[model samples]
Target: MSEPVIWREPVVEEWIDYNGHLSEPYYVLVFGHATDAVMDAVGLGPAYRSEHDASLYTVEAHVRYLDEVSLGVDLEVRSSVIGVTGKLLWIWHEMYADGRLRATEEVLGVHVTGGSSSPLPDEVAAAARALLVEAPEEASGQIALRR
Candidate 1:
């Protein structure tokens, strides 16, 4: 995996269920937003949406919370391509605050045609392949886990 990619911002309202920290659901939201950024980086953005009638859908996700993320903390999510085969892409992410690791998530996504799970067009696959990062071997773990 490569360096983590900092995200836009985490809104104050995102800090729900505060026993003095961000809620569980918000972590997923943060990761989701980061994934959107990845999609854009891989050439699947608004233009792709308007022109190709294609998109990606999450098939599974496993997240591990390593530490608490308190309110007002500045966090960034880093992602890397773990694996890609046929229509499936496996990705790994880590969330950090002030350079400290707080959480990690692994996701499996399927490139689809419109809302269906049909295989992605060759062009789309090629674009995504261009952005894939080589993952380390022996990176085995649960595909979905919650802290």
Candidate 2:
């Protein structure tokens, strides 16, 4: 099992919306950064990209906004692997600001060839498993409205 990866991101001006809160696209960007951190922890980073010519791509994503995040607020995004099957991995991410749950995202990604959407190789699957972290039977200290 692996520990949760914590990523800190400060809200930027471009991320602000008409409501004076972080925009939807920036939320995805934060999630994307968290995903990269996880990948690096799993031994799949730029080196792996160059060596294996492989990488993971998001195929599906669902995000639920529980609270609004304003600019200048420092946010923390925690991520962990929920499940993995074949070449597909399920990831869960939570955004927190001032220790409050602000948003949650469930993402499904598939490992593929660097330049194309092809199934991952056996070695990639094995490597991913080595870093796989079993999701808790239930996440504590956070309210999850969308499961």
| Whole-model lDDT per candidate | 0.75, 0.80
Residue range 1-147, candidate 1, lDDT tens digits: 345344656537547574777788888998888888777766667788779787778998888888888777777898776777778877777888867989888888898777777665666567556667776442456455777
Model 2 TM-score on a 0 to 1 scale: 0.81
Give the worst 10-residue stretch by lDDT in candidate 2: 135-144
Stretches off by above 4 angstroms in model 1 are 1-6, 11-14, 136-140, 143-147
Report the C-alpha lDDT of model 2 over 1-147, residue by residue, as the tens digit. Answer: 666788998998988999999999899899899888877866668998888888888998887788999989998998888877877877788899989999888788888875776765666566566666766544333445985
Off by over 4 Å in 2: 114-147
TM-score of each: 0.82, 0.81
Worst 10 residues of 1 by lDDT: 1-10
